[model samples]
Target chain A: MNWDAIFTSLRLASLTSLILLVLSLPLAAWLAFSRWRWRFLIESVVALPLVLPPTVLGFYILTAMGSRSPLGRWYADLIGSPLPFTFEGLVFASVIYSLPFAVQPMASSFAAVDRNLVEVSWTLGISRLATFFRLILPSAKNGVVTALVLTFAHTIGEFGVVLMVGGNIEGVTRTVSIDIYDQVQDLNYAAASRTSLVLLLFSFIVLAVVYSLNRNSPLWPTLRKR
Target chain B: MADAEKTMTNGARPLQVSIKRNFAGRFLLDVSFNVGAGPGTVLVIFGPSGSGKTTVLRCLAGLESVDEGTIRFDGEAWSDTAGKVFVIPQKRNIGYVPQDYALFPHLSVRGNVEYGIPRARREAEGPWIDRLLLILGLTDLQQALPGSISGGQRQRVALARALARRPRLLLLDEPLSALDAPTRSVLRFELRRQLKQLDVPAVLVTHDWEDALGLGDQMIVLSGGRLLQSGSPLDILTKPENLAVASVVGVETVVPGRRVRRERGIAQVQVAGLNLWAADIDQPGDEVYVCIRAENVTLEIGSATKSSARNHLPGVLLGVVAAGPLMRVKVDVGFHVDALVTRQAVEDLDLKVGSPVGISIKATAIHLIPR
Candidate 1:
């Protein structure tokens, strides 16, 4: 097994899901509750990655982070290095690619909460920010967990975006999906099959955990009975 | 106007609201009323389901904004469209119990009640919260979740949570409408007693007239998003200001009449070509509507001569319907007049359909509103 590729994927997925969690909480809240006139435009922009081809999204992101672009130039000025073909660039691309996975579930769950509970919180002299933390976050716990898990798994399975922006650097940006493609290119069928099996087993376990968390029945019903 | 000046000079700040809100294709809510400040002062916004009673309560709580006019509570401008002054609901310091009670499902009853207190003040305010729970009878269920409690218990938890914060004003929207009939009737008195003991001025909204009469010190009748009348509950029940108010107050007999002459303190009005005497008013209009409650009309078997009632009309009884403990007798005396009497009275008078009877109404019992 390609252990270095596995560890890099874990690091990138963990960091990307953490950043998305912090960013998506308030964004999803605003999407669920704001009464702004043009809110659908923002919603569409956030959901663009869900339907668009990953290569197309990667191409735009690549163009935006090229040496000639303003963001690319500002980052190089600050960190004394370019943004393309690095682990940081891969993290950035994966975050954009998996944003809809993080936001949609959280927003829907927040919207499903009884609005009177929120209004009652405000009437009790609790500020909106405090109410969000005290009432809304706890109430939407399952959706929040779902968002984190999906974002992590989606980032781990990303292939096209990482290859486009981060390139095939061995330890820097070569994640498990890119390692599988490299093994197949080299005619190493045994290594490729082994990696694919691990991925399939890991995805099944992740989904099992998600479904169990969402179920109303206890996961270990026999133990519960005892 | 004189009463307004009197309330203002006593150093008490009454809640004064005058607002106009448009719900696009729904209706235009235009109302203005005042709630006196003191313990045991409850102002009920009484109306039917679609009559914008909740809208008025929401505007008062700052949950819903008004499109025009102002809402001033305790001399502070909570909302003023012309001046662009609006206080958000968080800063309003209000205790609001919504229609469903809206207990926090994720928290224990104690946690729900302790939610409004600041984290730094929780330790200090623990005793106060305990007192609130004891008063509302939620002490035994403090550790239970809202879902595990009964409906009445959940309502008490909601009330305890609202009162824990010691808000400046309390707002309740159909507080007892979600319970069963038996529970609702029992909670009606319990809620009124709690509000009086808490000594906080409240604004309550309800479609049920019994809630309005049993719980309110002052009542405002609303219909079709318009303010029909504002007065004491007894005053509004006995003397509504207009036809709409009469209908909302459930006054059963309202007939159009024309004033024929005025003598001393009484006016002789002709209704269905029959003369009826009412207390005189100074209004110049001759056209009016005479309103009477069914309970105020007395039925006689024959021509009764020993009573002091001013108007007596002899007609045939049209219908007799059993209504709870009383019998509703309808008599066609020029116009149909309804009288509510006990079944024993009905049996003693031998009241049957197509039988001759005399209906007597006191001059003071007849209320006149301009047509």
Candidate 2:
């Protein structure tokens, strides 16, 4: 309810979404266009975090960086400490936790762009890089927007990953989800209700805007007709 | 290497699509022929379905990759498998119009026409597009989308788009077969005039002889992926190299026969079913195939009495095949021989399948060659 908490949640959600877009881009593009026979393996891995319980993912991240594995030990030496109980670790865990919500819509949307349009653009002497930026990404705008809003909202409402990794460290790692949990644990029901309402309202507003814009889109129906 | 060298020697000038493609398990298309386009030169690639006419165009346009060949347009090697050189389609400076009229559906008539020019030249596309629109009678439809226009309009739009490219060569794949009769005729005339006025070479593909006769200055007939004959329309039509081309060039019937005797210019050949006389038989050869149109074999309904035509054979009316206004009457005189007769003749004779009739062939009507 306070201005600082609201700002913190907004910043955290924005940072989480930015990280998600960067991490999911190649995976999304690959899923959209790759013809390799073993593509299902990459697809299943991207999709695994979605169906797997958020607690399960958080628990794995906790163990993976708990000085047990060689990667964790090496990372610990580089940072002079282990990854668990850090804000960066929470962001890293949340990116995987929110990947399906970010990338599935993008891949499907990119897949729906007309191959003829792409081929013609290429044959028209347009460079491949221009074709990707001007044609592919713009044409797949709906997917990008869907990815952005879903990742942002999903990250804002995160509880399990942050809890398992950040261990409720205040200010640095206590996001809106952890804040609400702390409020409820202290019997501060009013503060918890306010945070929950804001998150619910934020998600509803983002989803409503995305859905409304999609209704007026010409590219989406053309894809459906095809 | 030998094929490429021979083709270069044959087509050393401008017609340089010297290629042979083997689409494994599908079919083989090895066509090596050359005829350039200028004010009075338009090459017609006439063939049956799946004869690789369109593939030839694509190879030249640098669209379909060839297994072995050199596609040189204006001395630039677009593709040379032996030389391992290739130029992409955009840089080739060719205007390709596909069979389906592959115009950008999203663009307006003017937009489609103005597609080929560089962005810097776009501002000056006005006069060009205007001239093309005026030529195609599409001045008013410039703002209209392709879907909202007629088939003839779409054809003109696609043609204008190709023409606006100002390429060295033009490629059209059955541009008129999709239109109605009247529109086809109108577009045919307009397209021929435009091609001539442009003074650039063209390769037009079609399965229809009418297109060849109406538009082509250099007509090439093809069948089953081989060049049957190539020459001017009249030259190819009247003197096809073999039976395969004679049939394609409107010679309706091909009868396998042997030359028997000759007197002056006229020669007699004993065929399996009938005797035929042909003029100008320089070398009718040991065995020959006489090609004749049914209309050339004139039909006369008689009382078994008066007729001066020596080639008359008694036969029963087989059936009637009427396409549009023209009628083709098939007659079976013991052997199956078609007699293309006028509708008026059918009426006058009261001709039907069981109707008894007679067929006559003038000596000049028979175009004969080796089988």
Q: Write the per-residue lDDT of candidate 2 for residues B1-371, one digit (tens) a residue.
A: 23324433543235666678887757887877754445335778888888888888778767789988777755667889999888777777777777778666557889778766667987787787788789888899999988799998888888788778677777888989989888888889988888877666788998888888898867777776677777678677767877778766667777787888888888887877567677656763658877776667777777545655557778888789985566888777756677666678778878878888888877877777776
Docking class of 1: medium
Quality class of the docking in candidate 2, CAPRI style: acceptable
Candidate of highest DockQ: 1
Q: State how far residue B275 of model 1 sits from its true place (Å).
A: 5.6
| DockQ per candidate, 2 decimals | 0.70, 0.24
**Which portions of model 1 miss their true places by more than 4 Å?**
A184-190, A217-226, B1-12, B258-270, B273-286, B295-334, B337-365
Worst 10 residues of 2 chain A by lDDT: A217-226
Candidate 2 at A175: error in angstroms? 7.0
lDDT for model 2, please.
0.76
**DockQ of candidate 1 relative to the true structure:** 0.70
Over 4 Å off, model 2: A1-123, A131-223, B1-13, B221-225, B243-252, B263-265, B279-281, B294-299, B303-311, B321-328, B339-349, B360-365
Task: Please list, in the order the candidates appear, how each scores on TM-score for chain B only.
Answer: 0.88, 0.89
